[model samples]
Target: FPSAEHGLSADTEEQLRMRGCELIQAAGILLRLPQVAMATGQILFQRFYYCKSFVRHCAEMVAMACVHLASKIEEEPRRVRDVLNVFYHLKHSKGKRTQVPMPLDASYISAKAQVIKTERRVLKELGFCVHVKHPHKIIVMYLQVLECEKNTKLVQTAWNYMNDSLRTDVFLRFSAETVACACIYLSARTLQIPLPDQPPWFLLFGASEEDLREICGRILRLYSLPNVSLPSMLKEVDQCHLALDARIAKAKLAGGGLLAVGTPTLDVPSSFSPASKAGETGAHHSPIGNTLCNKNSVHVSFQKKVWKKHCSLLCFIWTPFWVSALRLTSLSVFRRSRSVSSPLRSVSPTHRQKISRRDREREKERERRRERERERGRGRRDEYSRRR
Candidate 1:
């Protein structure tokens, strides 16, 4: 979805999405998350990229953020520390070098902060509509409808197709039901099983043959594509960013570094909401994305406190947005270094209730009962002393 203004070709954006979705799936497994949560995270990741480009952001960070956000949205909450730990382990487990993982030090704290910030960014871009409609369950339901539910192989194949489709824009372009139908259609054909074609089984599910074909094509196309490596992908995106930066510098030199002044800056305040419109786009339009930044400058949080001049988005006016977003107050973050903490979230804190007058009087009566008991013991001790 990278427009011509984004300067990256559609293929590059697609690769970023594919790799990000793969990361979400892998992270979900390491975090022991359910398939639905993983799918939801993948959908959120894609929805984000539909508005943001790879050039302006880090794919790995966004992938982790989506997983973190989705887990909570799905009611299976994992703490920021646990999410970061799992992601860190997975990241290091891939290499031959035995790198001792960074302890829960300043570096980890920075990464944790980055995860929270990135998660907020994703939510903001999406207008906080993180609900994901997955087709995996629908595949089983449809299989049962066609009396093929008992066919384990076919069912598994369709389910796999649905999962794979998460790496593509088919979910964004079509309904979950349509994608489910396409998955079943592809699976039936692959397994050499005949479905009811007289009325076309998909028709019963409200999907046209054309919709099935389009979706199936996307599913099949995913397998044909080569796997994307995270490191290589990062390098590629970095190269694009470098090229973008160079172009911006050249333009600034040509325009005496004043071309970006009148490009219409966005007032992305801390209270920025969907109603706070940016540019000419609608209220629900992606705020810090296509309209805000034209690739002049990006302010991203990097681990080890390494900041990259990752943007040359002249029209974006991203500094103020980053400032407001970063100035957010988090009590948990403040207390992070002051105390030991668990990685996974426990029960939410309960509020202190006001005590009733009766309950308070009962509490006072119990105290008086203890006072009488002490007085009796003192009296007995005094008598014993007299006898001695």
Candidate 2:
């Protein structure tokens, strides 16, 4: 799709993708699909949208299609009707009608059709590459290899992190093994579980420290908690204001004692008031006569001069062309008016008579030429008869 057709900025598109991920998780729960199936469906949804725009496609329909396709790909086939029924049930439960029975109504039929149509589109967008190797299984396997399988807390937390990671584009950006290692490492750190740091555990999974750090940072930012110390934050804000004032003062000094035009002047005490000094300075530097209020008057005057010069130049270049065009148009209009008023006004009576006489003479000359040609042909035929 063209960039304009996406109908979303970068930030908005990311937010939409995050919302889609949440819906995918919710739909998976509603349908009671396994964890792997849910993860697969989320991956498929993200991949499809990487090449498609959310504005042109309905998110709910695409999410439903992803779940449906995931069921089949994961070898746990669920009918389209069942999936759509679950969606409709969840949708109505939040509204006034909580006990609406699923029927073969128009809405239900239309939803089913949409799901099927979006399912094919999703598959085509993915290039039929529906098989996604998730980091969940890899995390479990690695936990076992590290002999940390018995730590249920660590394993469970890492598993949750892996699920959360699907909401991001990390799946498309990084390899499964790298993501798996990062999640496991983060889980261990969160739980304060010790690991052998001599060789760094991530190296075993072929993940660089920088990649792991980037992944962990993204996960942290996703789950960022509110600051608990509000007083410290306020103090930092005050310090920032003071520093900004200092920098502004320094800039004024560096620029030959000329303050920024819009800056508010500082008040002075009566004993050491420099009002006269300020007035003198203003008289010397102000753009208008002895007034500081018209600081922008200089710019306005310069702009007026530039505009006048530009207009003059344009008139110089285009005046003759416009005048000639207007003259030609007026002449054509006058001719048209004369013709409309009286066609004979276009030519004098004498000129008309001369034109008619020339035409008659030309016609007679043409007739004489044709007669001579016919007589010559007859003479040729007579000579041929005599020879025979």
Candidate 3:
């Protein structure tokens, strides 16, 4: 195990952190809960790298696994089945037996599995560096540096703003010290958080003045804009977020509401139903509560038959509910949801009786309205004839 004395050089550490952060941010944004899961994955990543030496390929797998692992650690965990499922789905494979692309074939899975199996080896090599210093803690320290009195409304707003910045790449590239300074700087200037003297090293982080200006500018843009829909330029970033959520939700449903990532099934309660999001009402769910798919894989079987509607090009389309929710909470759902609608047989006993009843009531209401309109039209016509 490497000690603090034997740790990697600061430059090397920055590169590793940057790499790890990229994977985590990408996965989290794709999965939804970008800030929360990214923070969780970052802690795991720093600890993992702090111990064992870096092997280029193994490091990538460990980073992916760290994110896969951290998602479960946070309340929003993705299923292993979903992870493997997407790996297959992207290739248009029907099952796990299908061959993957040349480079990321079974060999890749084997390599990743090896890393996962011996993750404890890497952990042991790191001298058990589980505890991590987070940006939230640093924000508290900087608040004291600025002699901010308490977690008042102003203090809370600044803290929340700093948390938002962490979602972007800037926090990963810059040190906590530099980030703390910039955050305080930006917060004081934009949010009007009072600061007497600017910290000296605010201008001396590894990032160039141009980069820092851009980072701060994005943060400022976020603050100034009145929560408007982002323009088309940000679609890829938005799509990544949606894809991640669909991957997780599909896995959970397949796994019966628990996602197993190299471990036993952990219970994740069902929140949003895919059917409801697809505008399918009165469809019976699987016998299991939110357990819609295979626990080990993404193959799902529902209780009732569902008509298959394939919009291949629109497979990644987000439901309006998903769009609105993600707009508010920033959760993404990339897959087109599956919903079952009532059968078309108007009088078939096999069809839902309630549905037929509702349709009849609607038809009667429409007929009444049509009759009233015809009466009004006749009266107008008669008045015109009399005037003539």
Global lDDT of each model? 0.78, 0.77, 0.55
For all candidates, the clash counts are: 9, 0, 13
Per-prediction TM-score? 0.65, 0.55, 0.34
Off by over 4 Å in 2: 1-5, 95-97, 224-388
lDDT of 2 by residue, 98-176 (tens): 4776889898878898899999999887788887887787998999989999999999999888889888878988999
Q: For each candidate, C-alpha RMSD in Å?
A: 19.6, 18.8, 26.5
- Which one is best on lDDT? 1
* Candidate 2's TM-score: 0.55
Candidate with the greatest TM-score versus the true structure:
1
> Residue 384: error of model 2 in Å?
99
1 versus 3: better TM-score goes to: 1
Error of 2 at 64 (Å): 0.8
Candidate 3's residue-wise lDDT over 1-388, tens digit each? 2211233344433444554555566656656655666676766765665555442224455666766766765667676545444333433443566655445677767755764665555456555544434567766766775567474765676676666564344554566665555666666676565555344434443434455566677566544533322122134324434554565677677866443222345664466667565334422444443443244234433322232444432444756666777676642222111113323444345355767788999999999999999999999999999999
- Which ten residues in a row are the worst by lDDT in model 2? 225-234
